[model samples]
Structures are given as C-alpha cells and as structure tokens.
Target chain A: MKIAEIVKTLDGSVILGKENLEKDVEMGFASDLMSDVLTLQTSNILLITGLSNVQTIRTAEMADITCIVMVRNKKVTSEIIDLANENNIVIIECCYSMFKTCGLLFQAGLKPVY
Target chain B: MHFQYSIEGGDFSRAGNASSQLKKLLKQLNVDSQLIKRIVVALYEGEVNIVAHAHRGTIDVDIEPDKVFIRLSDEGPGIPDIKQAMKEGYSTASQKVREMGFGAGMGLPNMLKNADKLNIESEPGKGTIVELTTLLR
Candidate 1:
C-alpha cells in the first residue's frame, strides 16, 4: 500500500517526508520493543508502534524501515520528526490504538516481512 | 576514513547519533546496503548500550573499501557474566531505560548477529569494550 493510503485509512498526520506519500510499503511491523524490531529486519517496512521517542527513529534507521506510523494518537515531538527527516523516513501519527492500527493494516493485506 | 563520537552516558536523547552519522558516511561512500545495515545496526546497539548503561563511552568507526569496524569502549560497571548478558531477553537496564522502549535485552545478541566479527572484553568493575567488524565485497 502507498503511504498516503495508509494515512487516509488510519486518519494519520504526516510528520515528515510528505514528499514521499506515493512510496509503496510492502510489509508492516508493530512493536514497542526495539529489540524485537531489530530481530526482524524488514527492509522498507511500515513500522507501527506506540513508542514516540527519538530512539524510535533511530531504530527505524538502523533497520532501514522508512515509514513509521505512531499509534494511540501519540504525538511525535519535533526532535523525533527532525531525526526522521534527517534519516529520510516518513513519519505519521495515527489516532487508532496500537492493536486496531495493526489490525487495520493487516486487513489491508500488509503482512509482516519477517 | 575514521570517525569518532563521544557518547554521553545517561543522555538517552542522543544515544544513536554516532550510528546515524556513520550510516550517512557509508551512504556517501556508496557502501553496500547489506553491509551498511549490519555495521550501523551493530554499532547503534553498542552505542545505545554505552549511553544507557555506562558511565561514559566512545564509538570509533573505521571505514575502508572492504570493511567497516566499530569499537565502543565504556568505563562503567562491566558485565559480571557475559554469558547471562548475551541472553536474548535478559537486561540490567533500569526502569527509565525500559520506559524508553529498550532493556528487552537483545542488544548484545543483535550486535553479534549483525556483525561478521565480534569481540568483547569486560572486567566486572573496570569497564567494557565491544569490537565489531562488517565486511563488504
């Protein structure tokens, strides 16, 4: 799915990389634990997480995950957005809860790449 | 090329800056993505470990045409049992660190898994130094 579609479906706001709304996301991984995400290196995966810290961007950068959807209506700070911008990763804030966000994406045929 | 970053312990916000910078360097050099991923991931985990658990540390990145080496050294309470620390889900990080979405204990194992070569030397009370190397053709 395209990032724009995910944003529209999830009612998410783009925090960074607005220029890449048309980029395709092949898989999705939802986790608050960086360790689990590290264990699953899904290239270009759409990462959905409740964690809204700068480390989340760092984790995504390390894993080469270029898109992040923040669940539970969590607001990402400017620092996090700046990091995402620097890493060239797209950031979106979703109003849906973590479980619902994951379910919606899964229902949309986005499976785990790992 | 060589890059050095002084990682400040207890500074959670800036933990991965070194790894991120190194990734940029690798990208500019047009290094292999697979090797860059391994090098940066291993180095980032090591850098996070230093920032979250150590008193102070430094990350040294040595880049070459065929290999990238990272050496993280810290002066802090060393791992008493490296075997236990290496376990996938064991962590000694505090509640604060856990709140930041870490402390699930995959740091060491991830470092080892991502790097083609790994070496760790630690003294229980002295400090710890982690060495990682990734090869690129």
Candidate 2:
C-alpha cells in the first residue's frame, strides 16, 4: 500500500518525509527491539514501533525500513526528525496502541514480514 | 578502501553513525544491494554493542574488491565468557539501554547471522574485540 492511504487508515499525521507519501510499502514489522529489526533483511518495511528516539531512526536506517509509525501518540524530537530526513525515512505519528496500529495496517493489505 | 569510526560508550544517540556512513560508502562503490544490506546490519549491531557495553571503541572497515571486513575493539568490562554472551537471550545491558529499545541480547546473534564470518575476543577486565567479514560474491 502507498503510505498516504496508510496515514488515512490509521488517522496518522505525517511528521516528516511528506514527499514520500506515494511510496509503496508492502510489509510491516512491529518491534521495539532494534536487533529484531536488523534481522528482518527486507526493504520497504513499515516499522511499527513505540520506541521514539534517535535509536529508532538509526535502526530504520540500517535495516532499510521505509517508514516508521510511532504508536501511543509519542512525541518525536527534532533530532529524530533530522535523522529520519537525512535517511529519507518517513515518520508518522498515531495515537493508537502498537497492536491496533499493526492490526489496522494488516487489515489494509500490508503483509507481515514473517 | 579503509575507513575508521569511533563509538562512545553509553552514547545511544550516536551509536549507528558509523554504520550509516559505511553504508553510504558501500553504495557509492556500487556494492550489491543485498551484500550492502548484510554488511550494514552486521556493522550496525557491532556499533550498538560497543555503545551498550564498552567504555569506548573504534571500528575499522576494510573493503576489498571481493569482500568487506570490520573490526571493533572496545575498552571496557569485557565478557568473561563469550559463549554465554553469544547466547540469544543473554544480556548485561542496563535498564537505561533497555528503555532505548535495545539490550534484547540479539545484537551479536544478528551480526553472526548477517556476516559471513564472525570472530569475538574478550578479556574480562580489559575489553572485547569483534571482527566480522562478508564476502561480496
């Protein structure tokens, strides 16, 4: 699915990389652990994580995840946004819990990386 | 080409900078995307390991026509038993590190899975050294 549709489905606001709204992401991986993310070995993944920090952005960059959906309405700092922009990673903020975010995206045709 | 980066222990904010830069270098050299992915993942895990466990460390990356080699050497409380440290669910990371979404004890295992070769050397009081090699072919 294109990222824009995902924003609508989850009532998520684009916090960065709006220019990438049309990018296609087919798989989703929900994890707060960066190591689990590195193990994915896939690209164009939508990382559903509640861990909002520089570390999260770093994980996405190394793992080549396309976008990050921050669950639980976590606030993103400027450092995180700057790094995400540098890495060309899109960030979306949502108030839904991680489970709900994943379920909603899964229902919308996003495949699980597993 | 050879590259070097330094990692500061407990500096979670800057942990993956080395990996990111090495990734860009590999891309500029037109390394295969799959190989680059593996190399980057392994290096990033090593970088994070230093940040989470060591006092400080240095990363040396040597890229050849057919391979990439990385060596990380850190000065801190080294692992007394590398076998235990390499176990999938064993970690000595503190709660602060855990709060950053790391410290799951998966770093070394991920590095091993992604890198073609992995070597670890540690001294209980001195430090640890992790070396990873990935063949481009």
Candidate 3:
C-alpha cells in the first residue's frame, strides 16, 4: 500500500518526507528495538515504532526502511525529523498505539515482514 | 580505494555516520546491492559496538574489485570472553545505551550473520578489534 493510504487509514499526520506519501510500502515491522530492525533483510518495509529517537532514523537508514510510523503520538524531536528528511524517510505520526496501527495497516492489506 | 572514519565512544548521535558514508561509496562504485546491504549491516553493527562500549575507535575501509574489507579497532575496556560476547543476547552496554533501543546483545551476532568473514580480537584491559570482509557478488 502507499504511505498516503496508510496515513489516511490510521489518521496520521506526515511530519517529514511529505513528498514521499505516494511511495509504495511492501511490508510492515513494528518494534522499538533497533537491534531487531537491523536483523531484518527486507526492503521498502514500513517501520512502525514507538521509539522516538535519532537511533530510529539511523536504524531505518541502515535497514533501507523507507517509511516510519510513530505510534501513540510519540514526541519526535526536530533532530529526528531533520534526519528523516535528509535520509528521504517518510515519517508519519498517529495517536493509535502500535498494536492498533499494525492492525489497521494489516486490515488495509499490508503484509508482515515475516 | 580506502576510507577512514573515527568513532567517539558514548556518542550515540554519530553512531552510523561512517556506515552511511560507506553505503554511498559502495553505491557510487556500482557494487552489487545485496553485497552492499551485507557490508552496511556488518559495518554499522561494528560501529555501534565501538560507540556503546569503547572509549574511541577507528573504522578503516578498503574497497577492492572483489571484496570490501573493514577493520574496526577501538580503545576501551575490551571483551574478556570473546565466546560470551559472541552470544546472540550478550551485551555489556550501560543502562543509558540500552534505553536508546540498542545494547540488546545482538550486535556481534548481527555482524557475523551479515559478513562473509568475521574476526574479533581483544585484551581485557586494552581494547577490541573487529575485522569484517564481504565479497561482492
């Protein structure tokens, strides 16, 4: 599904990479652990995480994850947004919890990374 | 070609800078995408290790036609038990580092999984050195 669609479905707001909302996301992985994200080998995965830190962006960049959805309306710092912009990673913020966000995305036809 | 980057221990902000630069370099060199992914993962993990554990470290990257070789040497409290350190869930990172979503003890195992050749050497009071090699396919 496209990021735009996911945002609309989850009532999310784009905090960065606004131009990338139309980008296609093939899979979704939700985790707060950067280590687990690094272990993933998939490309174009949408990282649904509650961790709002620079390391989230760094992990996304290393894993080639193009999109991130910050759940529970986590406070994303300016530095994190700036890094996301620089890396061309789309950031979406939503009030839904991680579980709810994943469910909404899954219901919308996004497959799991497994 | 060769490149070098220095890492400051406990500096979480700049942890992945070297790996990001190396990824761009490999892309510019037209290396295979799969090989590039492996190299980036391995090197990024090594870089994070230095940041989380060592006092300071250097990342030396040597790119050849067939393989990308990386040497990460750090000055800090070295790993006394390489065997224990190699375990998947073993980490010595402080509580602060753990809060940043790292120090889960998966760094070395992740490196081993991604690199074609991996070697680690360390002395308890001194430091640690990790060598990683990924062949371009």
Please list the residue runs of candidate 3 whose C-alpha ends up more than 4 Å from where it truly belongs after superposition. none
Computed on C-alphas against the true complex, the DockQ of each candidate is 0.86, 0.89, 0.85
Model 3 lDDT at residue A60: 90
In order, what lDDT does every prediction score?
Answer: 0.88, 0.91, 0.92
Best candidate, DockQ-wise?
Answer: 2
TM-score of each: 0.96, 0.98, 0.98
Expressed as tens digits, the lDDT of each residue in B48-128 for candidate 3 is 889999999999999988888999999999999999999999888898888889899999999999998999999988999
> What local lDDT does model 1 show for residue A25?
95
Q: In terms of docking quality, how is candidate 2 classified?
A: high
Residues A56-84, model 1: lDDT tens digits: 98999989999999999899888888888
- lDDT of candidate 3 at residue B121, scale 0 to 100: 95
Candidate 2 residue lDDT tens string, A1-114: 999999999999999989999999999999988778888877889999999999999989888887999999998999999999999999999999999998999999999998
> Which residue pairs in candidate 2 have backbone atoms (N, alpha carbon, C) closer than 3 angstroms, thus clashing?
none
Candidate 1: where are CA atoms >4 Å away? Answer: none
